[model samples]
Target: MSADILTFRPAPLSQADAARRRAMLLHPSNFVPASAPDRDATEKAEEQAGRFDALYKEFLDRGLSANGARTEVARAAAREIWDGFAVQLRQHRAAGQQMDANVLAVALASIQCLNSVLPRRPEDPHHAVRAVSTARRRLQYNGGLLHRLHPHRNPAFQDAVATLQSLEVFLTRPQQHAA
Candidate 1:
């Protein structure tokens, strides 16, 4: 068989425009998942989870021993991370969709992130206690809600329950606060 060859034309974008397009595509606000609510929820959740992980690492790797300026910066970073997560959650709920894989993914990532942040009690006992308690509350809200949903249908709930228990252990460990 004889075939005619055709030249293909490609559309070109300016460097600045291309950069902007790439940024928009990568922006968390526009992230879309394969599934409904779940995809968006999962992406948003996981993104926040990563932020949590960063904060945890920062705290663990560089405790309050860091200079006051550095500590302030880290504290601001942590606050921003948490604030972003809270905003995403509110937006998801406001959208009025049944929670799905995306939401679950977010919840799972959140649990993992919080776990990573929990400090060992013997070191900075005061901060460790506070971090554990905060993580426990978040785990309770994230895990408890997911667990209560069709308990018989999902075995994964058990893992979430375990995560919750781990957080609780961190919260309740005995520590005499420094005077």
Candidate 2:
């Protein structure tokens, strides 16, 4: 008597299924493997975190309170972000391209960061007023261009404009009292 034998084979994936598999493999969140770009981005983020930590530690060593040290670190980070945004703005201007959403997003972040760190009533009100006014003018000018190019983002720019106006008023109040 002869014994019966059976072999199993899997069916080939369709084009759509194959494409989806490839996407899953390339995705950064995939557990199978990490892509090169993902690794690089993660490394950069880790390095930045390390630098910020070191700065915070330095502030602590200088005898600043925990809250004060945190504020100082935030201010340092905001300054760096603002400087990078300025460089990008210059590059975009040189290329004669309107500032895109990404650039405007950075400007908003910078403005928020500066606002968070600024005291409600600064000792030197004039300097603070000047800085706020300058930022407001730049944002308003670029925002107008951004609105023409990308109308959907009008609300964000409008909110930023309103914030700057309030901040300007807040900063100038001390001066009015002094007069």
Candidate 3:
């Protein structure tokens, strides 16, 4: 024997109910005023985000919006950072010293990219996130290799790894987007 099951499906809304719903969705302010504390918190949140968007081009030498020139500039910045790390990597190998300096550079690059390089967004929306993602990808790719080298617990090496991990966390975090 099969058991019969019945589910409560909401009936189609009446015309008056549908119109009221549309009005409610269209005019939120008509129902309630924004509270002062809520308004103040929203303002503060907005203030903290994109404070330097106007200066993204000034800092990075490219506009916030996508352009061939802007993409090139970002790639160039990553290349320069990589070149610096590469020189250090070669020096350590040639001089027969531990890979201390090169590892340090990796960590420093991660922090610098997060703090300085990526903040130069040409536009306020996803621009900063995209720029930071570029930097984060480069840093993590190299840093992953460095992590595998087993630096024998050198404090500086450990510190650099810690910093890079922290930056990765920041980049992966969910950010508040605009309404």
Local accuracy by lDDT, each model: 0.43, 0.53, 0.45
Every model's TM-score: 0.28, 0.37, 0.31
lDDT of 3 at 56: 29
How would you encode candidate 3's per-residue C-alpha lDDT over 1-179 as one tens digit per residue? 22322345556789999988876754524433223335544344345333223332454454334332333333344455456555666777678776666565665565465445443553332454465455555554445555544533334433333333332333233432211
- Candidate 1, residue 127: Cα displacement in angstroms equals 2.3
Among all windows of 10 consecutive residues in model 3, the one with the lowest summed lDDT is 170-179
Candidate 2 TM-score over all chains jointly: 0.37
Question: Whole-model lDDT, candidate 3?
Answer: 0.45
**Candidate 2: regions farther than 4 A off:** 1-50, 105-113, 116-179
lDDT, candidate 2, 1-73, per-residue tens: 2232233444568999998987675443543212233555444443434444567578779987654554555
lDDT for 13 in candidate 2 is 83
* Better candidate by TM-score, 1 or 3: 3
Best by lDDT: 2
Residue 174 Cα positional deviation in candidate 2, in Å, after optimal superposition:
35
